[model samples]
Target chain A: MAKGFVAITAERCKGCGFCVEFCPTRVLALSSAFNSKGYHPPHIVSAEKCSGCDLCGMYCPDFAIFGGRYAR
Target chain B: MNEATLEIPYEIPEGARNPVEPFLRMDRMPHIWCAGCGIGTTVNCFTRALLDSKANLDKVAIVSGIGCTGRVAGYARLDSFHTTHGRAIPFATGLKLANPELQVVVYSGDGDLFAIGGNHFIHAARRNMDLKVICVNNMIYAMTGGQTAPTTPATAITATSPYGVSEPTFNLVALAEAAGASYVARWTTYHVKQLARSMEEVLKKKGFCFIEVISPCPTLYQRRNKMGDGLDAMKDYKAKSKVRNGAPTGECTLSKTGEIVVGKFVDRERPDYLELLKAQMIESLGDRYVEPEEACCSEC
Candidate 1:
């Protein structure tokens, strides 16, 4: 099985939670720490479970988060 | 202090660059769209379509009118024109005529395209001009506040229509077909793959190609109408939409709470405006007519 990773731009996230809500594998969660924009960006809660589908990226209006796969 | 007690920090991997970044103006990052607005999703699909189509980016031009979706032209890292309200179609028509090699696309919202620009829309399709038009229908006028628009579904409450809109809405697919657009399709932001595919098809096709993207406006339209939020609208689209390719345009009418018919309705070959113009000129003017190439730089 291929592993995946997720990354988010802190300031770009508006805390709409679209990425977190739309993640198919439940790999992401909103961080308690707030960005400069006073919004809680998504954080990788389960990196090993990410499939890198990038649907989160597709649905994110802010262009804040992206997902990618890694070679074993 | 214990020697092994130091906490080794977990190194964060480098963030993956957004695939659509190349097509977007990064300096204009953090687009002004409200959180949960579907315009951004449409933009994502559009940029992906452009990349998938492998179009000559330099030869592509985007034109838009005054509205939220009209802002799309400004964010695209291409030759773009933000024209006056209801003038994007004619402006793009002039651009296509001046240089037939250029692929001109007009991106605008419902009110901008279907209201004030409604006449231009029909005539452009009537002439069969080679223009790709993407009309994002959020149902209401979102930019100037949630007001009743020509595409607004009947009985929807808007700022201007507090008691519910009593007028019937224009069926865009029917109108486009009736006016003679060579290609016509409809999709929602939820149907990103289909929308992108349609965009690619229209890019490669000639004549007036129109795509109506049903997007959500969470800020005004959704909030006023109590339509949940952007995600809810996507869920609604997923539940209500029925994809039936080649369905008659007359059967694609949208209702307040009925099934949404979506798909590519029309695709046919037609002699576009420029081709007809050249043929007419050749027959009428005979030897007196100078080809554009021959007329080029004649004064110099």
Candidate 2:
């Protein structure tokens, strides 16, 4: 079973762009689509290939994300 | 005849407590202060004031606006808020009103307080709220690459005032006293003991208290203006400053031809704003505020 990863709270994210630029594995990306507030939303580019590095969570300003193993 | 065995007792200087052991954050240590800058001396005076006041460490909150002096809040060992430029007074006012028991202090630079936040400063003083504000005036805006601040002397060389400041500076003590602050004082870093005493007095004052500490920013202000190094700047402060406790505002101007008056300029007692508000609160609430319940839970 693949190890699960953290979740990011979409609403609280300040859109500082730290997580998208920091993750070494290049798993996160800013989508062209916008959130309710009209800012760019962060999205997982490779959910199935997550390395569980936790870099995104560390760099996030809003404490929006948490990671764990995938659930059934 | 026993000169060889003059057993000396190991001693520390008066008010000396572990110089290397930082009561402020070391990560923020060696702040943007110029080498031997006097702001650090002011920071030391503040820490000493805290120790002298024996104020509840946990109940103390320091708020700072942007500039060189604003960095002090980040380093102090207490609940500190590093807020935006010139907004520390308003932020501290809110904090004091909210918690009444907290020792709220707003430490800011000349530019932050007298320039951008001048209106707030005057209004806060007029309200006479229970808060202490320490405005560190280096006579120039040491941050933002040296500009002519509200406290900058006329004819000072600065990035924005390449020709000369062409503007007279504000006398902060008079400004506070006229605005109705209960306590007002001005002291330079060379007057460390006096500054500490002023801080102590302000800490205990019931209404708004303002202490303007004249500090030296040798790096930006001095280097660009040819004011010499930090030590030289300090020597200048010591030699040029004239001691006058209650000198009129006109005599304290920071000019080559004017006397640099330094001392406690004003002190008075008045009904504090928070106390008045609390009295009004109790009168209106009529025991609702006093409603006591143990192990309380609320269902939202």
Candidate 3:
């Protein structure tokens, strides 16, 4: 059961830094390690510290992040 | 097969198709751009970047102001805005705020960004808005019949500048970096691959990203300056340009014989403006619709 609807789709993420920049609670962090696309991907740097704020999900240019299925 | 006059037939790989096509309407080949213009190459680089990044097509939005480059937004197969002269930044700003999920990009000529909408450009960078701006610097204003522009080299002949305009040109990359843009880069049309890679980098960057492409305006600037064809302009760029990476930020000056330093000019981290505003909105109105500014005034 996925309690928190907010999650990052690693394959779709392009490491554009939007999530990291827009996260109001500083919940998202871009890993130095590259994904399958040879580019960095965003991660849940402090998931335990997340407030379910959904800022990262809302600001992502790609639909890489989803939150509560109420994405903008 | 005879060694002296053998003709070889080559076929393109079926899987390795040209990505620019389908996205581009080749029937529209030889666009209205003047001979020796770099706009074609610039447009090619952009489309290539889009393909290389593999960004979500439906989630992209291209915005532009009035100029040769401004016409680019209309050609792209994405949600595009053919905005007013020198006002693409504000329009893009609105679009980004309304839906930050869209990849909003502003593609405009130097005059549009540096002269008419200079203030908006500065403030947009200062706010660190989550957007990408690709400004094509062809020195003189080409579309409006070749007039002197902020990027026009001093003493350059133009319809408006008869005895070599006395005014100095603007260093756009430096301006954006100083204004707080999180990502900034400068490249010439000669460096197609480099420009494409830079565009991809900026597309993935978090905050406001600014890229200045030194393109050629052969019909306008070249004819007036006797700079020959667009290829000649590229040759000039290669000869005159001095590649400088991570240069210190300050007032940008162009010396006659020195390098025209171009590279990843700036990359930094900053909180984007829209998210901050969103947080402020949630605190104030509890997710209600905020009234938009009515008039095109300073109050907005």
> Tell me, what's the RMSD of every candidate?
4.2, 19.1, 16.4
* CA shift of A32, model 2, Å: 61
TM-score of 2: 0.71
- Residues B1-300 of candidate 1 have per-residue lDDT tens digits of 121221112233555478788888999887888877888888888887898999999999999999999999999999999999999999999898878889999999989998999999999999999999999999989999899999999999999999999999999999999999999999988888799899999999999999999998888888877888887888889899999999999999998779999999999999999888889998999888875553245477
Instruction: Tell me what TM-score chain B of candidate 1 gets against the true chain B.
Output: 0.93
Across residues B1-300, which tens digit of lDDT does each residue of candidate 3 receive? 121121112221234323454455455442456545677567767876887888997888999999998878777668889899999999999998777778999999999999999999999999999989999888878998999998888778899988887986677887888899999888887666678889999888888999888887778988888877665666678788867778764534553234677888798888899667767787888858474443355566
The DockQ-derived docking category for candidate 3 is incorrect
Cα error of candidate 1 at position A33, Å: 4.3
- Write one digit per residue (lDDT tens) for candidate 2, span A1-72: 235454555544444454566555666676555555454546676665565555454334234443444444
User: In model 2, how large is the Cα lDDT of residue B290?
Assistant: 53
Question: Which portions of model 2 show Cα errors greater than 4 Å?
Answer: A1-72, B1-22, B279-300
- The candidate, 1 or 2, that scores higher on TM-score is 1
Error of 3 at B142 (Å): 0.1
Taking all chains together, each candidate's TM-score versus the true structure is 0.91, 0.71, 0.72
Sorting all predicted structures by DockQ, with the top scorer first, yields 1, 3, 2
Error of 2 at B236 (Å): 1.1
Considering every candidate listed, which one attains the maximal lDDT?
Answer: 1
